[model samples]
Target: MFKRIAATAAATVLAAAGLVACGSESGENAPGEGNDTVTIKIGTTDADQQAWTAFEQKAKDEGIKLNIEKFTEYPPVNPALDEGQIEVSKFQTINYQAQYNASAGKDLRIIGSGEINILGLYWKDHSSLDGIEGEEVAVPNDPSNQGRAINVLVQAGLVTLKDGAPKLTPTPADIDAAASKVSVVAVDASQTPSAYHEGRPAVINNNWLSRAGIDPASSVAADDPNSELAEPYINVFTVRAEDVDNPIYARLVEVWHSPEVTDALNKDSGGTAVQVKRDKEELNAILDKLTEEYK
Candidate 1:
């Protein structure tokens, strides 16, 4: 079942990359009304190219073509989608989307979720967390994710911060409870993989780790999926609020939840990116609150 879904996502993604027969509604795209090709432009960070490839292949058979635009950071992804420079983007957490909306005062909506999950703490020589004490721990320098990276250390019981640390701008001053002699270093997310060779234990993003061909399940000291951050932080698809009612958007959801896509993620994601079925009401309440939070 999962394999089938992964296959669909890769195929649908190809169509998303090319912009052909992309579905939308407007009498121009009335469902079951045949024979008009529409192009769908979707944006995403480069984390899920393989899964997107699976979805794109399936879209070709259905007469829709897609144009996929990739971004690296979290900031520019949604604004591009809303400008209709692209139709959708699948690069963020619900919490991230909410924050983006609130900061930008836009009404971006979550269309669906695919994969790309939490990162793992990795090292070349350390076999376990107990061995990591007093060593430098590497984390991303981005505001939201820097806090997230530190939280992983907390989860592993390697370091404890003063209460309310997450709400503040973290600096070396923020490490009120650094474990005796442990040190934390912040760098660009892109440099995390390379940090491993530098002999520091690294808290890495799931996507950056994957791009380096590292298997997260094997490298993790902790994962965000099973942490308190899971709900608001689940990765999701986003479109401008105006496009929520479109059937093509719904089809995008269908293609993601399809069995082919699921299997591929399970196999390819090192068992870290699990399929989570979010029923509509559940998603709505979460997204609604998140949207309000973003706004």
Candidate 2:
């Protein structure tokens, strides 16, 4: 199921780029190897956010020039990194990466940790989840987020799942409709805001809140960032399996957790992103566990 979805998403990206496949060959010398300042192309969806500006300046000071490639969606960024179109990417959760690796037969490695942008249930008409009972709620159709969205409703007592539903990535199929207070309407992550505007309460990812003119702090209910459930959703920086140990990548990760970058991130997220700083080994262990479950 994941392979079919991944292949379709990849084909869409390839067609958009007007290419059959991107070259997998390493494009440049490793950073900090000689007198030349090494340039690294990093992929992300939020390139225009203030955080990247701070990150770019910090990387420059370390003799690493960064080219920020802005992606409008999540599906293409991992494929771009896999094909060597970008050297590093920082947009997906470890759970999403695990699903991608399992479905695509790729072994991308997590090099650094990033913040968990708390997934929130937003509605213009309802001040709380109590008012959303027996109504249809919108969620991201993607596997990773759809599951998280369902979990959010479950936590809010607005939905219920069948016995033995996978806790890490539950889907609508797992929902006990008879017991659930609301029926889920899965849509593209980008269209969630649209669903909300059309009068359905929606589970909007943090990235789409601003586009919908919704404030981050206005969510009726949200996942607890510090909970055990959020461990798999920790956003991360990823590189090709071969570049996992590159000093330049390590330095970039170091700079990402610095006060300047984190402060900018907090500001951009409207203080909803919880900063996470786990080591590579710990992060990889979590990914490994999730990937196995996904497979």
Candidate 3:
């Protein structure tokens, strides 16, 4: 998935180079220029792209033009937004955003919550979690999602992490391998599904599941959205901290959470994404807390 994203990122940079040319010579302008119809650039994953049709039309009705930038991976969107090439992005979970902030030392604030992607442990060779006992398993190797995969395993009673392990970013080193039932391997986030298809029990991210032709409902075990661990995984729209209160950006977020967009997201995600309604400050508070933990 990320290979495709990397290839597209190069093309996007070339095509959008001229986009930054429209504003002042200083090149510090936001996406929209001096026009009646204001254009807001939003970055997101391909799975959520279908919802842009409804969101764009809604914004058009409000005289706010929306330019939807599609990304096949999470890494590119934040930098695009940070560089002023995009106004906002909705491609990452709060924890993932926190990971980025800690690494980049940027205070990009969460403007609103969009949806929750429930990750799960899937296996092609086994029918259930118990069936994979004593076997090797694969999970994402990224900082944020690696712990998320561990959380799923803990919830499934497969393993227990060490007492002082970071709950949100626990790695293989944190796992109590002696007490665990299966050997867990850390693989690239995009490869979990393929690993599962190749006979390893893998923890798969929801976004990549559909691409691998795996049904989320068929997972041996999945995250419970109502659970405490679920909060970090809820996807959010983020913008530069200075633009958090921009009225145009606020209105664009409003369109994103509208019923039409919600329905579109549900349809596009094949019912795997759960819509979340959260205010800006509350979302920021959550992000701030997670960012501190990430650091």
Which candidate's lDDT is highest?
2
lDDT of 1 at 106: 76
Model 2: weakest 10-residue lDDT segment is 18-27
Per-residue lDDT over 1-295 for candidate 2, one digit per residue giving the tens place of the 0 to 100 score: 1245643564455345543121224535332223334577889998898999999998777656787889999899999999988989998899989999999988999988989989999988777767677889999998778888988888888888999998878889999999988999799999999988888899999879987899898889999887777889999999999878655566677778778899999999999988898989999998998999988
Regions more than 4 Å wrong, model 1: 1-32, 36-39, 59-76, 167-174, 178-181, 210-215, 266-271, 280-295
Off by over 4 Å in 3: 1-37, 70-73, 125-127
Expressed as tens digits, the lDDT of each residue in 140-239 for candidate 3 is: 9977788889889888889888889877667899999888888899999998988988988999987688899997778888878767777888888889
Model 1 lDDT tens row, 1-295 = 2356754774466445543334443424422344444557777775465667777766555555666777877678877887877787776777777777778787777766555466578987667776666788888887657766776676677766776654322454477654434678899999988998787789887768768767676674765564554566677767777767555555676667666667666666677786665644465567677566434
Models sorted by TM-score, best on top: 2, 3, 1
Give per-residue lDDT, candidate 2, residue 31.
26
Runs of candidate 2 exceeding 4 Å displacement: 1-38, 70-76
Clashing pairs counted in every model: 50, 0, 0
The best candidate by TM-score is 2
